[model samples]
Target: MRSCIPNVLLVSLLSTSAVICSPAPSAPPSKGTTIPLTRRSVHKRSAAEWDEWAVRHREYVTKKYNGQVKSKRASGMNLLTDQDADSDYYGSVAIGTPAVSYNVILDTGSSDLWLASSSCSGCASSSGGGPTSAASNSIPLFDPASSSTFKNLTTPFAIQYASGQATGTLGQDTVQVAGFQVSDQTFGVCDTANGVLSSPLSGLMGLAWQSLASSKATPVWQTLAASGQWDSGVMGFFLTRFGNDSHAKELEPGGQFSMGYVNDSLYTGSIDYQNVPSDQVAYWTLPVTSLTVQGKSISLPTSGSNQYAAIDTGTTLIGGPSDLVQSLYSNIDGAQAGTGSWEGYWFYPCSTSVSSSISFGGPSWSISPDDFEHTQVDSSGTQCVGAFFEVNTGDNTPGWIVGDAFLKNVYTAFRYSPPSVGFASLSSTALGENGVDGIAPSATIGSPAAVVSSTGKASSNKNDATRSRGFSVQILALVWGAAGGLLLA
Candidate 1:
């Protein structure tokens, strides 16, 4: 939910060999369409700040669904404070009649589409009460008054997070993305948002099902799928990496987000599909059959909710049940539990190759050592934080949150028709520095090649592959003006 991008929704027609676009072609629509995603590196913060943010984030998420807090602001807490920023990968979306664009994070963990209103109380242009970060100043606010078709529903809208919150009113308008437009799409127009909008990002676009939407509105993708706009009810992601590259830019090409079909060239071999259990169909939840460290299987919770996992693109870290997480690190020599501000976290030697894999009733997919070994935890340049964290979601929610740490290792597809998730190995060309090729070799306690710098950046020797090509489509582009008219491309 913390990523960034612009608001122009680029729709692409996909084929087997190359990506090309035209204006108003006669060919039928392809099976799938794609949108380009941009990566925004987070501003640096202390490790303690990150730890504190994580704790609060878990509490907020837990409370949100526990019925402890209503969808509207039940705690009268004013939205303030700067939440620690996480590395974000987002894209553009255009809403309203005039087709104004806004950058939004594409999140699968939660379902709700919202934009910061131009009349936001905490915005820099409004009364002072929001984050004063320079990045927050650059975020564009959506002015519902400017859109001729905007309709206020008069329903209260509010969602509270650990360090920030957004409170506003529900509205209906035309929501456009990937060349498809949904008329009267219900979304929140926040009059006040705190610590949410960052530069180049004005809102969040949730991709999960309607059951999880706080607004009680059907998600954009589900709307499209129900309308038969896509040949197949499926969406796929191939997330790229830039954190390890010393020469990484602020806005790099993150990866592709495909709708309706999977790009054959992006992944290798056949995809292993896992059906979502009936009880966990709200999100992309799958049963985690097994977990292994150094090629040795570890004991997992046999009963209760600990076996289920939600594959979330919004989250940056891999999280599991407390006991399972402890068992995972116990296999790695020199691994130790973090103390004080870093409780529920673990750290290991920087040079340790902590090769790991997770299974979802299919072929085991390996996690890269580079992904497992996170940031540096010690000034002596020895201890490094592990990407895996401990989450106590209780027995009602999924016990595991499989996030970018494990996601970047494989090409993932979310199918709507049958409610299943699939994973495939990345093709040779698609495999970057941290991409997994196959089942990883057993981990070594002191592997020199896996050693990172004092700053915890990956070695410069790792190959940074060329980014995947952007997709395009041939359709009549909709150009809207204040006069409420559209011009065909």
Candidate 2:
């Protein structure tokens, strides 16, 4: 269950954290290129108020799961309906031949690209920037009628998330990101949208695999990879957080999303890689060997079919089985069951530090303590909301939803060849510990280099052949084509 209760609201209700590791050296950054990313605050809502809403979303997910599980068991269905919301990183893209630019949120959890349409009715409409109101120049919408290269497809499309639904016409056009352009890209021009999707955000670009896509059309990244525009087929993400803390306070120039190559300087230590299970490949899901809080292991059942966890950039909070969630908070000092602020939410003293981390396959990756508290009342107040919540996926499989709160600590790489995800600690510079020097430092000592075999192991540092950075551009392009239509925005 996903909540459209506003991403900021969800942030104020959950808590979690992780640790750091020494950095590693790489041959050099692949001919990868990066596009600037920025954080957009979900303004106007109070911390307490957002917490209340977030708790309700947790209950909603659980309630919906319980109700659906019974029917699914009786009917023997295996489809997964994941939630989407609370994205903070965004970049710009242009659609059509003339290239009309629109600000779009990049999401790794879902697989679909959608934007507001000129024909949208009963939707938030405005223009220009600076605190917009409805019924004006909200955002520049795509009009298929105006674009000479637009191809109107018969597929009527819709996507549902925690907040609301987006229903629109499916069409194809030339889409441009930075200077690279992909022709005949399929996307949705939403005529109707619900929740607070208007005003600031104009569209969403999905980055997950094509199996999760709403349309059969090829994804944006697949097209770009096949276009021979990049040196490698890989895509990388660096997400920034918003707050007063030095570690995560929003970036001055902001975070970034790299295409075709990984940035060697944005992270430290070796990256740990995990293959997305064949069944869960549609999402960037991974097997979670264990979960710990401050080095203390939380006893989660190891014998369940739902042992995997989805590392979602589109989501804002961490969630899991009700029991596991409770157990995690039980170890924290001053953590309490939410009361007037909200239910289903666990509140802890603002000063509480949860040394939390999660293991996918290899060594456990740590989360920063500063990322744990989503909301704080008064500077010296007694309570702050956490970033972990309880949400049951409506199936016997009990998977975890790991979101931006946890991801911001690591530099993630989505490799296409072997269908795996890799994580390494963010560079100290990226973590904001040294100073305001915006430049990312060289990676630290570790073995997150590319895989040498199908077993997901790092090769010897002397050989350095395991890392995919040395792949010829032609080979990389072929891998991108063989990667079977996964998309990224």
Report lDDT per candidate: 0.58, 0.53
Clashing pairs in 1: 3-88, 12-472, 13-472
Of the candidates shown, which would achieve the greatest lDDT relative to the real structure? 1
lDDT of 2 by residue, 391-443 (tens): 76756433677877787778888876567889988896666632232432111
Write model 1 residue lDDT over 132-204, tens digit each, in one string: 4333445567788888889999998876655456678889887665544567788888876543443444667
Error of 1 at 378 (Å): 2.4
Q: Determine the backbone clash count of candidate 2.
A: 33
Q: Name the runs in model 2 displaced over 4 angstroms.
A: 1-33, 41-48, 55-87, 125-135, 194-196, 226-229, 246-252, 303-305, 339-341, 377-380, 396-398, 433-489
lDDT of 1: 0.58
